[model samples]
Target: NATFGMGAISITSEREKDVDFTLGVMTTGVNLLISKPKIMDSIFQFMEPFSLNLWMAIVGASVGVSILYFVLDYPSEERKFSARETWWFSVGTLLMRGTDFAPRPSSQRILTAGFLFFVLITVSSYTANMAAFLTTNNLEKQIQSLEELVERSDFQCGTVKDSATMNFFKTSSKPIYRKVWSKMSEGGLVSGSKEGRERVRAGGYAFIFDYMINSYSELTSCETKMVGTPFRLQEHGIAMKQGASIKSILNINLLKIKESPIMTQLQTKWWENKRKCDFIESQPTVEFGIKHMAGVFIVGAGGLVCAILFFLSKKWFVAVRTKEKSAESDTGLEETLYTTDKTMSKEDIANAVKV
Candidate 1:
């Protein structure tokens, strides 16, 4: 027969020894944990006597509470504590933990509500994180966008062990998106070729299907332009733990955020704010010098030169037209005068012959 009584004693004794060891190092370990955040050291310190003792105490208390609630002669678990008892117990716990000083009735209510809210939020957040991981991992080859990936060269291209894009000069009816991650990890394989952009910029990686779109955008110093059609218009959403009601609240808020024109405007503003010169990149001085003042000067000077030539051409054209009009008028006058003289001479000759 298993000795339940001895089992309890053995467990308590073991826990007591652990507590003593933990407490022995608590002072030093606490200092180091606070200052350095060394995980190994912290673990060692956590094994100290006092720390172990505290842990044991917490476990023992929890176990005792569970036993009392379940095994004791109580109508229900709800009957274990009255409203005031529950409230005061919560307040005392919070105070002892240095979370709250003195808890008023209203404050207790608020804290209770807040605690519930936080629990919901935490559950939802975890769920969302899990969902994201699953979605991203399940993709055969994941890349945020082609435009984003093509901008850099350091980003690794990954694909399945055998794929079409991996085979150079292979013809295919469908467009192939290259994988970046797998290629980098594979031994004795190299991605060939560099483009004009990479030649100009250092640290540019030609990643195939890496989903680090933001990183690519940063490297390219361009608008976060995505390639091809957007697969989906996705909004960042909160996922919740299974059976958590907080997910609904988050979804509602997300919808409101999506519907708000402010959000669109904010995004536009952000993209605009993120704008960088393709030619100059992060070199603000160069870009500013070129675009702001020097460019204007060059354009102005060119316009001035064009204007001068245009004005001179206009003047020359007007002068040529005036000369042509004057010549035509003078020729017409000369012809009229000659015609009159010829007519007068013919009449005189006729008269003379008749006489």
Candidate 2:
């Protein structure tokens, strides 16, 4: 008696008496595997990772923060840091190559810290996600689901010949299954899983197979990925003669192995790891919008408004002080002129009385 290799022996109710199967080693389901699309050619495609609003917000932030920095630490009537130097500092922080223009006051230093934090997070996210966008292909149409597979007429799908997966479609009462079986009966059958996937790679075709094998192919070398949710959930077990004496012992051992870390080790060796590929995949990427980064923009806008208020308040105080100085000088000059007039009148009166 022989147990199946890997996860090939699917446990079925009909074979329970004749074949004494061990507890399932693994579970898998049916799914379709398709090739990754080639990269599409387009203009300004590199900027796709972040939405247009996000890009504009980033630009606005750079300018706003620079202006805020200039207003905060700048001398009222002289130059501590030039506007040109402040701008370079802003750009340098984003480029991750900070300049020598450091802020002097608490407010200016806090502005620098907030901006540096924003730049650190934003730039890291951009560089990390940029690869996915750069390698993107314009896939305007894709059969992402089984219902889509049924509806689309442009391509045909196939499976291994007389396999349990095919039998399932044949026996299923659902119209979609019946229709799929009908299409397969005509010309969609292949001799084995490998040939089925080969037909998939030849283009204008899709292959439905057990998810475990196809999933491994997707990770490693096939440039293939599973589309849609898996169906026909089933377990693969070790098959043996119905009354084999070692069945109970074997079942016990299998359970022990499943309960231990050995199961995880095997899965990691075979499935969890990905082999290096020449091209990186573009999928599973995030498209950053204003919402994802709203906090950064809000903080920057608030800083700009605060800086403007500070500037206006400084101007008002300076104007008030200048008015006070001018008023005191005018008062002193008026008093001196009045005293001179009084002295001249007294001298004239004395001269008249003496005559």
Candidate 3:
């Protein structure tokens, strides 16, 4: 017999029992590759970027700020703004329309600024987020996890027949892997790794292959990606039959290469080719939570508080001035009465005093 040992041989427990293997040179794992499809959305697709709570917040903020504006402007002497006018002003501002009836009160101004700032942030982020979702094609739903893949009836999977990947699925004690193997029995078994990849490329098929190739394939095909995390982590080594004399020699040389700087250089030669592809995964479709826009919310709340404070202070100042004027008028009237009493008799003073 001839020595049949080289790279690309997956080192596994079953294989190790029959043959000795050299130190692993390449590390890889099994993963599923599926084609990306365009997902159709409802008429309200524009709302996908932000959560429902966020939409409600936007509406609540707008209505709440407008009502507050009316409350502050109702009693103002400087502006003759009605409830209808105030509401229309708020709507115009939110819609990015120009309006001449800007609030004159200091507090109303602060509230408006805050509302405008929130609108600016929301509109800009919404535009960017919507664009990313539309372009990324992440809206297309497929089996995103192993459990989902197992339950998926529309998609089928397979691996290279009699290959290490196939063996792993076949011998795995995990119910999940066993179920996968059972499905493969129905069809999707390919003669070679290349054939398996081809079936995956045809669409509606998931191919169990090396994650290294999975990654490279994603780079070349922008519409494809790994369904879930890579499973069955393993290594490729020189596989040899039992009692091979060159085992020691092969192990020593492979270990040396693995430890030395040449390993890095060699890996670069294989993976770092002068090529690139467009990527959409991990780009958009990521949900924007409240924390992302906390600053905007904070600014708006601060403005609202400041506005309320200014409104209260203005009312207090006006009250104080009115009280002082009333007191001065009473004093003046009393002095005039006293002068009348001095100039006229008790009878004339009685008529003026009106007991």
Candidate 4:
């Protein structure tokens, strides 16, 4: 009688001596299983799109460009303004809330136009990145490779005892695999894949098992995920006693079935159709939160402060100049009156002497 089962049943050299293995029914490999990462809450999560250094660079660029604009548009006596006014105008232009004054010189106008173009490009890029950052899930992966799994000490790793994956690790010649095998032999190995999966779901534990089963388990449970790329490439084959005549016929038919559309339909029916979890890959809804637009409000507040200071300084300068002019006019008028009195007195004395 032919024996067939849907377990791992890999066609290794050791197993080939006792039983015949038909063509691979399913291709799979060992994969790491861990709990799904939780979404972290951060107050400054909105600033995640750009690094601190990048943000600093942007600010530096704006300041440098503003200085360039001020130098290019230096004012004349007819359209005079303080250094502060020129700075304010340049900053306002950079922010796209342009100032009342426009550059009169061709060189200044050209520079201003170039700066506007730069601002346009920068603003567009920032907006697009911010939108993506707010709407997309950028979860940090806990483990990405076998090397990482070995390096991390926060979680204990395990696999089903006497399974194909366990045997692969135990027989491997590589130092990393040898180390993993030692750990597994000590206390990590579990009796069944189900127990290993349950340990993973409980957290602080990692399970190494067949990729196909891991994929199926992830679809069934929402809180568990298959992490990292597969380590050992292996195939599942139908098992039969050695020297079985039906092996050749079964292999031929298996190849035919694989080539047909029936295999794909069966795979879809088993994997996709039976998924228990409601997994949707839709864009996350983004709301206009204060954190998202904090920079805009901050810039507006800065401009308002600058405007207030500029108004006060202008008023103070005008007041001081007006006071100095009044003082000079009063002194000149007094001198003129004294000169007229002296001339009138001298004229009256001369007329009296002649008479």
Candidate 5:
């Protein structure tokens, strides 16, 4: 109830809070007079704060650190393991010989590592992009770059929800970040409605905040160009459970992927294609393409990889079964003829059976 009251007061307060020392002392004194336990007292002697605010500050810092580590660093599914469960499992593994405590044994580790690596790579690429953008002087234009953006003010820039783009806002803010959760929502791009992607493409908003490669892929199908330069960039690589043994394989795969010609070709195909963005306001198709190209590539690649793997595995199993049946048939003719015949000798049966 007290917390609720404080929250209500905070939300309803007309003025911004200025935490002066006088106000703090007055509040602490009033609480003491009201039969409240002295804020300075601590159950644990070592944990005691020098002052009430000092205690509060420590608590606040702990909460903030926890949020950043558990929430911001990874997806929710990874954090679903409870504190008690994680602790016991970890302790048991360290105590018990030949124990692997990791929840993700194989594929999950690979996927997580790959995802993080990709994110790191994207960040680095964006950083380089930002540096290049800053290097090329543009003194003549005031609102020349996508980096100089504001929400519902200048240009509408968007990102995918629960993505690194959302995390980017916590540290960097060169553009207004809007989240489009789905392909359909992205296609619509509604401003002030979480549909910023669709709106940006349609000229209801301007520019998108995404990885350079993603933007490049999108440009292949869309008219909206990745103008000016990248606002932010950092290393985006795969994530693992702090330390995992598959580091060598993960690193190798990442290096191979980066060096591949496929990625280069994809970049060219998307960026080199010319389209009329000036006429984007007139064409619904053009607008849709611009907003939705990035979304399509991501979804399509994920689906395609899954499909190919499934088909190949199915084909391999079929071939193995077919070969096994052929081998069994070849060895069975003599046995079949002898087993059925009561009057024939084994040699006669062997002679009589077809080769």
Candidate 6:
């Protein structure tokens, strides 16, 4: 009687010609193994939530709305003000600070109310989006398929030499598989799965292998990940010499084992409970440092400085105008007094002559 051996032996036509394979015990495929992508740190990462064009549009909208409010709130001739006051009123309203001058006309009041409503909506939406963006993590670009792996030149691809995975790539007629095989052959193939996996962990490389093996590797390695869906559907079966008498008996036992709870217990013991790496979903939200809000604070400081300069210039101009007016009034009064005294002297002299 021939002996039967069972393992992850793939059922292939060439192998079948040499040995008889029992019915498939498990089905799996080949997948790409790669290092987990690292999240990149950026100095201006806070601005990533919105695009440059969107940010520009928001600024433009704020200024446009402010200008509109200024035009609508223009005072009448009796209570007239310089154009500067109108602009200040509009900007103050935009900033949610009530302006010194209240809107008097009904039309002006209505327009100001509508603009405030718009501001409320815009600010609320921005706050909500910003919060979400800050709390959530940004994902790095990932390789999702074999075609992407072949097209990208950044990652070197390889597999264990003389392995099933290597054979699959070497014999594949597809252009992507052919390209991958060419690159791997040129770069030199890995000796075994361990070396291939180590290459992936070191980064800048991707290893192709059986999905089952890759899954087990990911459980044990923290920085390793299995990416892309499996391909080349392969079935694992028991292999025995051709015309082996025990093949029928072994197939029957394999079917029974698959249907029983023993299979589930075995898989759980190996894949889950034996995991070596801690599962991490996301890190804590980073607190915003001075650098994060530096732009906002700088802009505010600039506006305050400009306002102070404008106020000082306006005060100086008013003072100069007031002094000139007072001097002119004094000169006119002195000339009038002198002219009156001369007229009185002439009248008195004429009276004396008549006497």
lDDT of 6 by residue, 1-355 (tens): 4476666678888788888999897899999988875543678866655556556655665565455445544434325434676567666776788767765644445555555665565556557656865666434446878788877778888988987788988999998889989888877489988998989989889998889889999999888888888898999898898998888898899889988988789889989887987655332233333444445434543543444454455557768999998878666655665576665554454454345
Question: What's the TM-score of every candidate structure?
Answer: 0.23, 0.50, 0.53, 0.50, 0.27, 0.52
Q: For model 4, which pairs clash?
A: none
At residue 17, candidate 3 shows an lDDT of 95
State the weakest 10-residue window (summed lDDT) of model 3: 274-283
Pitting candidate 2 against candidate 3, the one with the higher TM-score is: 3
Off by over 4 Å in 3: 1-31, 34-40, 137-163, 166-284, 343-355
Write model 4 residue lDDT over 1-355, tens digit each, in one string: 5465446688788888878889998788888888775443579876656666556655765666556545544443335445676677667876779887876644445555555665665566567777776666444335766777777777688898887788889889999898777766767889897898888888878888888888888888876788788768877898887877778998999999988898789878988887887653323323334455456545544543444454456567768999999878766655665576765554454454345
How big is the RMSD of model 6?
10.9
Which pairs in model 2 have colliding backbones? none
Off by over 4 Å in 4: 38-141, 278-355
Write the residue-wise lDDT of candidate 3 on 166-190 in tens digits. Answer: 8888888999999999888689788
Over the stretch 1-355, how does candidate 1's per-residue lDDT look in tens digits?
2211110011123243322111110010000000111112234432322233434433443334323223221233224444444444443442334232333333233334433333343334434544544333232232345434434353433322232223321232334222323333443123322221232133223322222233234334442222233221222222223444554555566567666787668655654456563422121010111222333334433543443454456567768999999878766665665566775554454444345
What C-alpha lDDT, on a 0 to 100 scale, does residue 348 get in candidate 5? 82
RMSD of each: 40.7, 13.8, 11.9, 11.4, 32.8, 10.9
Model 6 pairs whose backbones collide: none
What local lDDT does model 5 show for residue 3? 12
lDDT of 5 by residue, 1-355 (tens): 1111111011111122321011110000000000111122225523221233433433343333223223222333433534444444433432332234444423223323333333343334434533543343222233334334331243334444444444444344432332222211333232332244345445534434444433433444343434445544333333333334555565666567666776567546655554323312111110112132334335433543443454455567768999998768755976777778867887786666544
lDDT of 2 by residue, 196-268 (tens): 7777777667788898888877777545667888889999987777677777887799889988999888888
RMSD of 5: 32.8
Ranking by lDDT: 3, 2, 6, 4, 5, 1
Please give the RMSD of candidate 3 to the true structure.
11.9
Backbone clash count, each prediction separately: 30, 0, 0, 0, 25, 0
